[model samples]
Target: MQYYARIDRSCIRPAKDRQVTKRTAAEMDISSSIDNETTHKARSEGATRLNSLVASIYIFRLLFLAVCAAVRIQLDNGRYLVVFKGYPFYEKRAVRKGTAVICSCTRAQCNSYIHVDRDLNVVHEEIHHSHEPTRLIPLSNGRYCRSSNLPQMEFIEMANGKVCLYIDRYTFYQRSPRVWYCTNNVKCRSYTALSPDMRPLRMKIDHCHPPPKLLLNIFMTQRGKERLVYHDYTYYKQSRTRNGFRWGCTKNRWHRCKAYLHLADDLTIVRSNMEHTHSPHGTPLYK
Candidate 1:
């Protein structure tokens, strides 16, 4: 009864031996590798989120600056409106010679009206009417003067789109001539005097002088062929007699007329027979 059955000794191994210890070591190594991989992935995700946050901050700052600029403009507009409303309304004056006033808004829709003060008030004029109409004329000293109590003046438009005012020496009598006086109050830079002889000392020209610089040498192109030929000029008076002529060393031609001769960018003769003309109307020689 005390006898035990024969047991296989190899079937049971020690649980605390080196074979169990080796298996545990392998599992620990695997777990450590997995944990390192997870930590690297988390760090990459965190970097991407930080970049997004920085971009959003930069955009927000830009929007704030734009809003500030808009607010400043609105405040300035409000101030201007207040100033416009405070100005005095119109008190009527007779529209006579030498009388000038800043007439408020001409549009029918607006009730705003303000009479502009003249540069100088007439000291000895009747309230009802003026003796003679204001005359705009140039003084003998080459200055412009306005005589009317309502000195009506305008900028004379020249053919070349330039403008000039007729101001005589008498304009210096005005207190605020710089602000009140102008060719129609547009502010004039230069003025001209009317000459009794009706001849101008100088005239305005549309063309600029010292002449344009030649861009390139003159070469004749005809029938898809070009030859280096010298040019010439010829000028004839009413009698059809040649008075002036020039020789072209490069093109080997004679230049006759300074007005008709066509020059290259280098000022050399290009064509002799072709008439030189400007845009629009062909202006003859001006004095």
Candidate 2:
């Protein structure tokens, strides 16, 4: 260790004071140089260790829910949870079997999540996520599935013959695209969008209100009283084969639309607009 310099001014020879001070200053410079070199070497070593650990890490799948998936990353003697780049990390303490809880992103510290019915389907999610984690980490296998791999459209089908389009679970459940029709709905010009809870939204209107259904609703004269054969809202029913419900034109309930629809559990409209309302514009040609 370098010591502090002390000089005696009284009875000290000029030549002696100069010599001693010069030597002390030179020693301090050398000591500072040595300390800097030591610190830099230590920092470099630490960085190398960290890089090695990151490179050797491996992620393994643990569990999967209805929409969310779990993974664990291990490298050397350390292990960590592998979550989506911007999603919140749900620890064991925070997770409950069937609760709707909000979670912020573990890294990005933005947004929330909701797990409903224990399936943990995203009831609501933020449009933007702050954490943009590294997408790709090369594994031992040349061909492996990871975020870095090429993106492709994924279709999720339910047992009922409906289909939904999704890019990935990261997009959240509410944002996933679902097929819808306006054959039985009063609001015919509405855009196609799933509700925040991943359920269909219905717009209520008066019975006589026109739904812009020029094709389905040809102004039928029922016993000299003009009536709408099919409403504007599409309809849905439990599918015979699939676990989910089948969607169709709501006019099927009245048996007037005569439309045939084969809806799949995945929200796909396999068959749509099955010949509802035979009248070109009205029921009677000469009423």
Candidate 3:
């Protein structure tokens, strides 16, 4: 009875293992099919979105180009003026005031417009012209004229805030070759031409010979030996006396302090201490 039971149990084990293997294989197939379907759906959705975005962009670009084609620009007077579609009133006022204004302009409108009048009309019959004559000012770069014939030019404001002409040149004025004779002294002549803007050039003491240099001299004695110091308005570069003594950077140079000496350095104490001890002015020394 035991041998028969063992043979039946062994036969049942093989059948059960085969059924488990079949179930696992079927589950794997179903999972793979679901994953494939999900991947296909995701890819289709992504493609549709991408196509829609590209189509929208194309439409927007086309609309923008069409709008741009409808707008144009125009010039008025000497200034290049443009007719603004939106806020037309503001733009007109800005143009009249010579102020900058922005307007919605398009490329097609820009090309379609043509300049009717090349010349600027100041008034009807008077034909308002530039009152100032064309001035040819020599520049470091080259010669330039106030007329529009020059390559680079611009409107400049004067000190009074009035309109003036400006050129894109380095130096505007040149050294006039004409020699101006001094009315006071016929012998004297000047090469530097003063501007017409200032008062008439007058003969001054500086025009004399010896070109005004600092008298670097020193003095020791009080009589005829006293050095005549020719000092201009500038304090630092003052001419020194001839008697081997003058106002130097240090107090050691001046034998007698012409002015009240400030105690600037330790060396300044030399003269002060000696003057105090000896009573140099014959005044009674302070106790």
Candidate 4:
């Protein structure tokens, strides 16, 4: 008896069907990977765009702040002013608990005004004008004045070869290319603002003390020798050096005074010791 091997057809798949199944699975995987890559690319592009937008906003904000600073100016008298377009406005009143200020046109008849916040942002404005805009000239002292009222400025050469700004009777020394401080900067808050060309823009003439006075006087003695008179006290030459001369008080011998002074060849007081044991003799004849 010829017996054929038992074949289980249900356990076997066609080669074509198996191949089709494997191809379908691989296609699905490729499609899923393509989708994942597309999603990741999209996210990356979005993040890049967001960063660029933020940077642009930051730059714009900086530019806005610069513009605000240019418009709002503080005067040397502690007053604030706002310049819009070509017109100038003075502070009229403050509202919102001093957080906001209302500025009015300089012209009395004009109804134009602006409301500015503490940050100098103009929140409200009425820019109507009744007359021509007032022209203002910036001063070296961080103040502004009418163009027609600009003062004449003078430049003087100091003894040490440094140049100083002289306006009225006050003197200012250069502190920077665009600013000058009062000669008495220690106690004075005065200063002058200068333009790029070193022209005086504004001046603050507030001085804490009066101008310095010359207190040392040169006197000729009967022996044709030179003597120094300071504050009614007389000083005679004690010794000489290359840089200067040392002087002793006239009463050094009798009163044993220890006071002395070092005077330069240019008559400049280099150093001094004024511990006198006695009072000044009399009024200086030279003075």
Leading candidate by lDDT: 4
TM per candidate comes to 0.20, 0.20, 0.23, 0.39
Poorly placed runs, candidate 2 (over 4 Å): 1-24, 27-34, 44-48, 51-287
What total of clashing residue pairs does each candidate reach? 33, 21, 12, 9
Q: Candidate 1 on 1-287: residue-level lDDT in tens?
A: 59889999887778777688888899999999989988988998898789989989988987754432111011111221101122212234535553644333322344544333353222222122212322323333433223332222223322344433322211211113232222322333232332344223321111222221212222322233221222221122111113323322221122222344444435455555444332112223333
Can you rank all candidates by lDDT, best first? 4, 2, 1, 3
Report the backbone clash tally of model 4.
9
Model 2 residue 244 lDDT score: 38
lDDT values for all models: 0.34, 0.41, 0.31, 0.74
How big is the positional error of residue 210 in model 4, measured in Å on the Cα after superposition? Answer: 1.8
Q: Residue 282 error for model 4, in Å?
A: 39
- Candidate 2 yields a Cα-based lDDT of 0.41
Off by over 4 Å in 1: 1-16, 69-287
After superposition, candidate 3 runs with Cα above 4 Å error: 1-13, 71-287
Q: Judged by lDDT relative to the true structure, which candidate is superior, 1 or 3?
A: 1
